[model samples]
Target: MPSAGIPGWSVIIPAYNEARRLPAYLDEVVAYFEGLDRSYEVLVVDDGSSDGTATHVLEAQAGHPAVTLHRLAVNHGKGFAVRAGMLAARGELRLMADADGATPIGELKRLEAAILAGADIAVGSRALRDPSVTRQVRLHRKLSGEVFNFLVRRLGLPDVADTQCGFKLFRAEVATVLFGELETIGFGFDVELLLLAQRRGYRVTEVAVNWADQPGSKVTVFRDGPHMVRQILAARRRLARRPSASS
Candidate 1:
């Protein structure tokens, strides 16, 4: 139960086989807002982890009622897990962050401030010149990420950099609308969600945030890259066939 005070934010973390990381992430989030006067909820979508991730969450529930756990019966992709959590959140602002906490939870105030400034969506961007974090990632990962972004730009979501950043905040209303219409169930689902928001006349702002690449990520370089390319092409074609927001 939350404090009987104000309606606050929801942080949804979609986790899959991340038992090692979930405890630390939960602790960090809990400690980050320990003194804040607002309410904050953390939803962990355990996408069918065989590594006992859900059990760990359940065990941790003795002290953290604000932390909720949603278990998927099987291993769905990150997109599916995130969709489940966002749609289930009950806050004015809903944020889906990585389970590994790559982007520090402390920077959430910027995203919340963006929402207060009338932005419908706020996403983290590693491509910005001044970032809050700059270590822990392998150079090859950065190179491949740039290559993917170059290809993704061809789909016409301009002025948007680093679509792959796992930390993002959205107005709950906008999140409901966009996540409801999302079709992709994989990593490229982030791109699809952004494309849908852009088409709906939503004001999306990219905030330059600190990001530390965490080890033990589920993404495999060779396998996920080709699949992401296919998803981008599919998203482009789908958006091309639909009418724009003004229509």
Candidate 2:
């Protein structure tokens, strides 16, 4: 169990119609965290899936008390689900991982180490190569990622190499502050979060971790891509006008 005010770690997964894929990842996360010397909690925020995603999460709860489920009445975007879970999490360290388990659960250690070393946020970066990632992504996906990262660098956060990695860890206080103030409710939330972190003068680090592109992903490059680009540009302008802490 966690000490008085904090769990050792909180794992938050924002799942949208992930019934077929979420179950196994849940088991893997539970098993991995349970063996650690400290206490942790796993919260799955179901983004109003018509499929049995919520039901599956509830079933997993019966066996694992640390596992919790939060259901949205309608399909809010991934941003909404992740923000809700991040605010609700009670861990000293909060991590957001994709339901697809593209990055292995075992890779949490790398992010955790980065935070322990003083980064307020630690993001998993596929751009940085590591032996852990066994499968390389398809050409189109790789191209899109490079394009997106380039935009993220030019228009928004120049320091972060990969904004959409789906794997990030934040100190509880930092996560709460950033997510509480978030305005984006779509795939671009990752960019917005980092933008907020940079605005707040928080240190963010990128670490390489194992990742495998999974099938049945919800993102459509042609559809969501342009929207995400707009979001980053809009957020940058919005943040620039806001008064900073130093102001």
Candidate 3:
């Protein structure tokens, strides 16, 4: 439930040089939320984009007052941008969405249902095979994602099928706790977040959602895959040093 004057949902978009790709998604998000009766906000966290990303967001804000822009001083990783937005959001439910809009904003209903049902965190998964869920992914990207998820399962978070998916919804307090303790500031941050959630006994539900591989993606498997793997290993070591809530 949202406090008085506070929005029920906050969509957090972490953008880095996404001027060419973000506008359409922003419009889609605004349109979807406008149809609903509940109050909502869109927080676009510009990750020091040299492009006109911030300017575009400002222009959108002129039209839609619910659209807010949070500019980062320097180009940090996606994890850092999302953490900043999550911490700054005023909504009861915070949704972290990719700027490229791989998953349609309409799919938010599925994650929201999971959260309303009982989950503290609702992760949108592309790997889950649900008759109602559809995924159109490239072969290479799909293969790489499978291999990476296998590594993730071996490391930890075995229950989560798609740990790298950027679409995830978190309850207000859950977002604060998980992101406040976040250390992996790169692409592999999702693995660490799930690990921390598991350690703290948060109810995380994986929901199958419709996803499509969009053009102009920031991640290149061949280039960033190894770096993400290293980050995951580093996060494991860091968590190993920390005591769990039960401990």
Candidate 4:
């Protein structure tokens, strides 16, 4: 059994209609944390999934006390779901991972190591080329991602290579502060969060990790791309108006 008191880690997964794709990943996450002695909690936020997503998490909770479910009344975007989970998380280290499990749960070690090394935020990147990291991405998705990232750099966050990676680790305090102030409630929230971190003078590091393109992606390059770009621009304007700590 995990030790009593505060949990060492909180894994927040934002799921929307992920009944078919989430179960295996949820089990994998639970199995991974079960082997370790440290305390951890998995908060699977169901963004009003029309399927049995909430029911599945409830059933898992019966066997694994650490697995909890937070259900939204209506389908909010991934960002809103993740923000809810982050704010509700009680662990010292908070991690937001995709329900599709694009990045393996084992990769948590790399981000965890970054946090332990004094970084405030550690983001998993598929853009960074590392011999140890294996990435199996679809050609079309790869090209679209490259184009989108180029825009992201040109607009803001030139320092960040891959802002859309769903795997990110943050210290509890940082998670609270960033998510609490978060305005973007869509897929573009990652860019805004990183921008806020930069303005807050927090340390952010990108680590290459193994990733594979998963089927049944909710995002469409043609449909959601423009929306994401608009959200990023709006976030930039809003943040620009607000004075940073240094100011």
Candidate 5:
């Protein structure tokens, strides 16, 4: 079990048509956090999954009380689901991770410790060096990641290595403020959120984390890749036209 102190955390998992995997993933999340000293709650955001994803989550509630379900009647993007969950969460620390379990929820300590040390936001990064470097990503995905990171660096964001990592934790104050400024509902949500955080002058820290590639991936590489690039450019224009925090 992944144990931590009392009043531990509020975890959010956003799912879109994940009926096949939500059953087991939710179980692992709840069971792993069972014996912790922390009082935690898990909110499953069913992002308009038509294939009985909400039904499965509701059925599982028969066994787990700490888990709650929030259904968005329409399919909103990942960012919208996460923003809704985080804003509703009442924990001292708010966490929004993926339903895929690519990054184990247990390793949240890396981010938690960063927040405890005064960072407002702490995000996971598989892009950093480690023994599992090669296993972190496949060739094509890795190539796409490098290109995106290069552009992000060129646009003035050098501290963030992996903006798309599913694992991230934020203090309540930070979550409330940043989630308010979020507009993108798609794949580029992280990039905009990070850029907005920088605009707001929040101390966002990136922590390297353990990762295991899982199947049933949702990102459409070819389609979303171009769309993400557009988002980055749009974000740049938004920042340039809007007043920055330091300004």
Candidate 6:
């Protein structure tokens, strides 16, 4: 259980059956934040994973007081899980990260700096300046990602280079507002989140970070690709209809 005060940072991981890969990341998060001497909490939203993902987080909580678990009764998409964690977080700064740790946890310093420098949201970008570290995906996956970015730009958000990157940081107020209004409950949720943030006049910036393509990704070009496109289009329409908040 968290104390009454807000933590300095809240790390929210939307996990769905990531039992094998999640523990290492948890260890890293615990070690890194503890060493930094900042008050922090780690929330693992288990999206109804049957593979004992909740159990692992529970065990982690036993070892670390900063760790917590939220279990959904049924498997929801990544977007829903992330939304759950983001809305429930009690940190001054909230970060939503992939359970696979595609972007190393240490890269958070870059994002924290951006937010402190006046950006309301700082998102990880694989397309920005190169990093000493690189992640390799299949050639076809790489091509498909390019195509998806093209569609994302055409659909609405032209300024964002990579909308699907799984690492993003937000101020607590920003996270609560955007996520509270989220409509997409799937992979396209990131795109929608950024678009809404822009519409609300929030400063959003992309920061290049070390990223690697982890195995066991949930996205597939053939099956999920088309669904994601539909979600994007729907998000655009939904946002267009939404009354903008006063700047």
Leading candidate by TM-score: 4
Candidate 2: C-alpha RMSD to true structure equals 1.7
Instruction: Report the lDDT tens digits of candidate 1 across residue range 1-247.
Output: 4534334878899999999988898888877756687787888999989998988788766577778899899987988899999998888888899989898998898888888898999988888667455645688898998888887776778768889999999998899899988878889999999889888889999988888888888898799999877876787788888777540
Q: Count steric clashes of candidate 4.
A: 0
TM-score per candidate:
0.94, 0.95, 0.97, 0.98, 0.92, 0.96
lDDT of 6 by residue, 1-247 (tens): 3334779899999999999989999988888887886789999999999998889999999988789999999987999999999999999999999999888899999899999899999998887766455766678877898999888888877888888888999999999999998989998899889888988999998988888888888788899999888888898888788787754
Off by over 4 Å in 3: 1-4
Candidate 5 structure quality by residue, lDDT tens digits, 1-247: 2323434678999999998877887887887678676788888999999999998888877677667899999997898899999888777898988998888777787889899898999988888776633344677887888888888878768889888888899988888888877877877888888998988889988888888777788887898888887887887788788866651
**Pairs of residues clashing in candidate 4:** none
Q: Model 3 clash tally?
A: 0
Report how far residue 115 has shifted in candidate 3, in Å: 0.9
lDDT of each prediction vs. the true structure?
A: 0.84, 0.89, 0.92, 0.93, 0.83, 0.89
RMSD of each candidate relative to the true structure: 1.9, 1.7, 1.9, 1.2, 2.8, 1.6
State how far residue 117 of model 6 sits from its true place (Å). 1.5
Q: How would you encode candidate 4's per-residue C-alpha lDDT over 58-142 as one tens digit per residue?
A: 9888889999999999997988999999999999999999999999999999999999899999999999989999998999989
Candidate 4 wrong stretches, greater than 4 Å: none
Q: What lDDT score is found at residue 233 in candidate 1?
A: 76
| Candidate closer to the true structure by lDDT (higher is better), 3 or 6 | 3
Ranking by TM-score: 4, 3, 6, 2, 1, 5
Instruction: Write one digit per residue (lDDT tens) for candidate 3, span 138-192.
Output: 9999999999999999998889999988899999999989999999888989999
| Sliding window of 10 residues with minimal summed lDDT for model 5 | 1-10
lDDT of 1: 0.84
Each candidate's clash count: 1, 0, 0, 0, 0, 0
User: 152 in model 6: Cα distance from truth in Å?
Assistant: 0.8
